[model samples]
Target: MSEAVDPGVAATSEPKEEKPCVQCLVPEIMTAWNSARGACEFVPDEKGREECRKELEEIAKDVKSIKKGSEVIYKAIKSSSNPAAFIQAQIEFAKTHNAANTEAILKWADEMEKAGKEIPEDIAKIVKFYRIQAGSQI
Candidate 1:
């Protein structure tokens, strides 16, 4: 004789079709990135740092494949404690996509200044370049 299975258990056995939501994913990815960054800081050894960096790289890979992935990467750049990584991601993105939002770059520069975060000279140059590019669009 077969034992009765609970409806909830039967439901769990079947895979449900679900579409991914960008809004839901972006926050989760950012949170994971932030947590990994925080974990990196507490790591005193180089090996520990390397591990943390690997985890961050994995998350970065995930960012590139999602819908509205550009938005996620851009926000990550803005909020990153180590913006260099995200900047590299953005550069790679631009290389393939041949697109970068000038308004967003300028706004990021402005926001960084307003927040008392010093804009690296290289980044300043990039912002300037984008500004000129934006003007040329007119």
Candidate 2:
């Protein structure tokens, strides 16, 4: 005498795929990081502050990863007139985002893209992943 009225909500409730658009989700993640930063302001005592900072750093790392994913997209969409300036800005932005080595590595990628070549498999692989931190949960 089993009731045959069960719905498929269990299957529908499962999460979707993880790899979102490389460009679209960066700012969204940044906004979440910002909210965490805001909460960090109220963390009292040195130990609590340190713990909050650690979580913030994890969120920052994810932000850095998002920026890397972004560069994989942005090189095509760069707006500056000079490639030199464009690359320079990208490098600076990467540094600001805590990725000091990213610019030098990306320069090679930029050259590859400039030559109308497809992104190398290894580099393209970078664009295939994203795991954003759960910011502001503290």
Top model number, TM-score = 1
- For model 1 the local lDDT of residue 137 reads 34
For 8-32, candidate 2 gives per-residue lDDT tens digits of 5553457876776756776766655
Total colliding residue pairs, candidate 2? 0
Q: Report, for every candidate in turn, its global Cα lDDT versus the true structure.
A: 0.62, 0.48
Tens digits of lDDT, candidate 1, 1-138: 977787767634677878688787777667555544544544455665565566567657767575553454454555555566545544554444334466667788879989999989998888778768768431
What are the root-mean-square deviations of the candidates from the true structure over C-alphas? 14.9, 17.6
Q: Per-residue lDDT for 81 in model 2?
A: 30
lDDT, residue 120, candidate 1: 97
lDDT of 1: 0.62
Model 2 off-target regions past 4 Å? 1-18, 63-138
